[model samples]
Target: MLSTAFALFCFLLAADCLETHVHGDLFVPDAILRISAQNISIGGIQRYTTLVNGSVPGPELRVSEGKVVWIRVYNDMTDRNTTMHWHGLAQAASPFSDGTPLASQWPIPPQHFFDYELQIPNDTAGTYFYHSHVGFQSVSASGSLIVEDRSNPPYKYDDERTITLQELFNLTDVDVEQRITADPLLWFGENNGFLVNGKTISDYGVIDNSTATLAVIEVDPGKTYRLRFIAATALSYTSFAFESHDGLEVIEADGHYTKPLSTDLMQMGSGQRFSVLLKTKSCDELEQSGRLDYYLQVETRERSAVATNYALLRYRDTCNLPESSVHHLPTDSYPSKKPIDLPPTISGFLDYQLQPLVPNNFPTTSQVTRRIVLNVQQFEDGYYVWRDSNVSWSDASIDSRRYTTPATPYLVSLYTNQTAYLPKYDAAIANGGVDPTTQTFPAKLGEVLEIVLQNIGSISKTNVTPGLLETHPWHAHGGHYYDLGGGPGAWSSEAMEARLQGTLPVLRDTTMLFRYNEATQPDVKSGWRAWRLRVQNPGVWMIHCHWLQHMIQGMQTVWVFGDAGDILKVPRREVEGFLTFGGDVYGNGTHVPERVHFSEGG
Candidate 1:
């Protein structure tokens, strides 16, 4: 159901609009994404949902490395505002295009289009993705963004394939959102099924002959293929395992090449990506075994009923067909490889072992200019809500009408020299601390920051057993950082630096903070994760949990890099119409603002 009529024409336009630059050439209007509400079916379950180009998971976009491209996104939905977030791409110079609503820029209202200028750094060449950053639309509105290597890559492969993993929600996004945010919190942790490239067999405790198509990745025998995976799930920690294949060499993680490491099992949380080289079996061996297809089993690792999904990895010569197509359910006998029983701790296996291919000159503890310690906790003020330390990120204290999604974006107020509308915060709070009034963290331009996120058992307003702990996948908006790893009880900087032994850490834009409780680790009561980065990108960036339910409950805050003047340094043409109410700053009158700016800034 995806529309592809404008592919060839878009490429031609990109070629003709190139302008030479220092890093590479810049292409204007490289591609156009049209978002609309469509009636689509996934795994035989139909739902009226929002989609990009009328597809559940949007199309894969492949571009050469070290290139800048302008992508135009149009929202055609009748009643929803949206924004696009490039998951791993570092918007170094164009910070406003980071695509976080209210923090980076205003959300693109319905029936309007916005142009996003994406600059892929020369060093960033691997797997990544783009998704909606507002509300729960990311569940259905997302796609893979691949930056292919212009020259010869480090690893050789005969072919390549992309697999996007997700969780299926049978209800409408609005209904689901209301349930999660309802006073009674009727939305318990229950999902319909798991997805592999938007296809799966419906095994929700029923025996129905639904011939749903499974994603088929055909490969020639005795050839190696690079399998790129993006975890676009809203609330699932997925684990993948090959039925009869082993020795998958992981070469890339989060758009950065890693030292080659072989593993039989691969695990990923939301907003994460990786690349693995899979070598197919020989033709003679496959013929002898009387099997030309294998199953790639995917399982959800959350604390619930483990939903299983399957995808077919077929050989090229299967059934003597020209090309092997999708494998439907109930046709062939299922593979013997079922989902493995793995502990939650095993999910962090690759985080510590996979080192960066390019060594980094790590900074010593003495060089760190600031350190931030944040505690993750859950409370029940009226309904259940998650928070960082003591406060959650809602603007109800300032403006009750616009609680989470502000009527006036903080960036717009800063640009127009209107500070009264924005949240009040003390930037001189020594070491750049969090301001509960504004729910923002302020940092200088060139300071090196070390952030520690500590997770503790849930605290509530009632007397009951503490809620079970869950793995929280934290993601950053502006750029990537060095992952220094996680711990059991509490975070200790001295201990972490000593353990490094003057070695560099793996670079990533998103990582997981493990949870601890009486059941998991009796000796330890809390868990923690540490990361380090240089505060170079000048703009308002958001740091939040990738899980949609938690994010909606206010488990997020914004980081203001540099001052208002620094962010205003961005070219006026890039953010002209976006900072105002009409969305006509780009000299075109297409966009419409959904809400009025009640503050004086507008």
Candidate 2:
């Protein structure tokens, strides 16, 4: 009897993975939606084509447990090349069709097509999305890719809806480049306007003439609904909430199931997704009135921005809640501003320094490796830049590694370079400072590695964002490690360079964002800074910003897994040299490295 019951339970769990008929000829469908600014008195005044497929928010695709999913992408864009990446869904198995250009696969050229197959091993369910992994994230090219639930869920919901709030900077491909290259801070793409479905916040203000105000989704009030939200903006931090006649309840986040957290305020950032279960107990409004109201509010002010979307709860007149008003909030319905329990601050999101969100789940503290900081400087023009000669956009450009010259390393001339150098905002780190002639990435793996991101020059709060001091989420492709804090230095440079004379723990495909410094307390909401990960995965994995821009600018690098824990055969090599990392880092993916073959005498 016991064996029969166990077998029955397993059958039920496996039954949750129902297959969906996929329309091949597409890998990540570039969305084609309409975008118009809100509050435009005249209708259709400012309009443009958005990258979402057939719908403003594209379709969601789910892969089965232990199955391979094949994707064929068709790019209809006549202008820029486009590619799609299954964001947050790392490849531990084949890692094919990962969709990152050059580093992973070549991008699908304009008006062309490409096909890829992903071999998903273990079963993992979550609310994930696929976007143009090639270049600018906000300019165009992004859509959600949901991996359906193969296992029965605990929550009860009759329907499910995913809301992706995106921002649009109405500039042409070329125009955006100039603005970003000139003043990355002012570039609207960084953290500008938004689109729900494919419209803007002030949809009500300009519902008739504006294209941005059309994401009103209709729903029935008597039925339970699930709202899956993804914060896909480059750098727009939000504390979002939903309001109908009553309040809202949230159930899941980052695709992982979580205990319900009922609050009027919740925060989400780029690369993060959440699921909210909206119950219909008080859904009587649909019957009494005529229309059930759902409101999404967003504010773009001095230091913050927020946006949210909801389904218009519909009912067959017998429901119990207010019916006349669809989803209505008082004219001034936004809650009185209150302190939120969000991550302590932006630093909490930057895990390159003191990774806060990363799980410190590694073996024993066998190794303590330290990385040296090369550059962390912010400019008056609102852009920030990091410099180091020891890294490559894709580990070593070649599939193979070469040994010689100790990678010809060098520390930047901070004092001299600070005053003389102008800030760079493009991705083109093609430099000869380190002799690519001999050096390679993941030098002798299996050794305890400590990568330090030193901040030199000066940081000005007046020009940069508040989270500048905070370390960013540093994700190691093939390993996991603990988080060490971020500061001026550990104990003097010489003493600190003692190297990891110990063994390091093992980590696999984990990520961590750094915490902000509490010294200059500004906002104590998002907590994070720097972190370390144990490299265990033995493959070529690339790490970059979930946001498209920062990543386009050489923000990505390769993590190579050498022989596991073989320090003797793969001993570290110490050498003498001065090399600079520069160029193509800020270019479009395919274009970045090419720039190295052309300019600065690379």
Candidate 3:
């Protein structure tokens, strides 16, 4: 009887193990995200907004590093198309999953679905995010992507939190786009309020005694917490800080580990993320002194209109009561203020030195194979046009309307031997022409390329502030680049050589292009930013200004690496899948429509 019982137990154990492997481990991080439009209450007013999985900020997606993730996105919205870009993920082997509309694949139209299979590299374990890549849809359809490191971490922290920073607008996304096209100078409409993690403190002026709940962070005494802050705003650059809390350690920026630097205030531009470690005070002492509540403040930067938003941080064990029962601190405790005063040495966000914790194995500056100089300038041929290297990037619909012929997708052109869409550098430079509308620079695989971005200030209109240059945050897809030092003025070959003689550069995916100033002691001139990276990933990659307005206005370009022969190595099946479904799928899955163009008129 004992032998028979033992044999039966073994059989059952085998069945359980088989089921676990087949169902649990194989599909560990699978998710089905439903995209639709819904009326949600912000502060007190109800407004129609785009949403993913029925939430403003969507859902927090956590996946372990070195694992595969499958996300099936279902578009249920009746009016608009949707595509989700895994921002900051290299998408090295799976370029189709990059999710750039037209460039990677067609937009998922209403009542359609798309499955994205992504493999997270073992080395890329950091804070990232996902958002809509089509039009202004990302204003609401966005979420945080946290990649957990399997190995031990370099820093110590007892707990962690993720906070998404955004700005709330009264006008819908469609209305905002229409306004942008009508007013050339208007990039974004006025934002009504700011939000922290899709929640904010009720503003008495905007709404009358609203009962909106503020985002709360509960922490134990004597414990350290790591906070991952993501700037998901469509238009604002935000400065964040915790009142009465000091010794914040910034350890990571833009999904790359950086040298630990301590700072009082942290600044983040759109599409940027930073991780900071905060040490909490003891609960016993705080409760005794009646100082258990603290405020997390976020303020807008680099804009004429400014607003501040606040959240709550309370000690979990201070009162031994539920979080909802805890009384909120007085609204007047944290007053809205201008930029906080910091020492001259650490005043701007660019002042902090971000050195990569892990050394990259790439060629040095002296070993660079290709060098390109691109200048950003605003010109007026018939209308205001922003151009980089003589060409203002545009899509098929825009080119067809302007030139009477639809342009092909840059990525498709690169891999399929369609060279018309590629930029003719020699002709463009010689004639100072920006014809053809679509532009791309070509590079060979494994070549170390250096791109110097020279910024020339545009002439401001009489009604606008004169002599004020707009600050641009530039971002690149596919891989992170090494940020060589940059300075004021057009970056000449001599200037680059002198700058590289100084300290070794760091790795960064998103960087700021500061405005030029001539009267300063240093006599800053037109801004210049430079970066170098090897073309290890053989695919078409996009490099563009992160400002949503700038990107839509042709302030973007692509770097096509390798020839058609090299692209053939990428699985034919995968390439065929994109070719079959790419371009505008709004009607009949064709490239264009007679009356409605997907890429024209904002």
Error of 2 at 381 (Å): 8.5
Which tens-of-lDDT digit does each residue in 1-602 have in candidate 2?
12465447547765321111223333242332222112222112343433545444455666665555655565666655556676656553433245655443445555454444455444346677766664453334566767666677757788887778665544543454445434344454333355555555332243344342335555665567887887666544444544443344566544445555554544555666667766664444444444454455543221333333222323333444443344443322223443222333333222222111223344333464423232332233344332234343421122222101112111122112322221121212233212243222442344455554443333444644443433333434333344343333322433332332232222222232333332332322233223344554444455544434444333455443442232111111110000122221112223311111001111
How well is each residue in 178-279 modelled by candidate 1, as lDDT tens digits?
A: 777776567655677777887765554323336355777778888999999999988887788876898999999899898899998888889989899999
List where candidate 3 sits over 4 angstroms from the true fold.
Answer: 1-29, 183-188, 201-213, 284-289, 318-352, 379-385, 394-408, 413-438, 459-468, 492-502, 516-525, 570-574, 582-602
Clashes of 3: 0
TM-score for each model: 0.86, 0.60, 0.81
Q: Which residue pairs collide, candidate 3?
A: none
Error of 1 at 537 (Å): 1.1
Q: State which candidate, 1 or 2, has the greater TM-score.
A: 1
Who is ahead in TM-score, 2 or 3?
3
> Residue 197 of candidate 2: its Cα lDDT?
58
Report how far residue 403 has shifted in candidate 1, in Å.
6.3
For model 3, give the 10-residue run with minimal summed lDDT.
593-602
Candidate 3 lDDT over residue span 1-602, tens digit each: 12465447648754211110112223332887889988877755566888989997989998888777877687888878788888889775665678776465567777666667677878777898998877677888899999988897788899899989877777777776555543344544456666788876434444423535566777888889999998888776677778678888888887777778887888777788889999988655565556666778777766666667777777766446444444546543344563344222122355326667777664676788767776776543233445677555533234322222224445655556556565554543343322234455666677788878777756444444333455667788888888775666667778767756645566778777655452221212377888888877766677877766566556676666665555444433224434544322222322221111111111
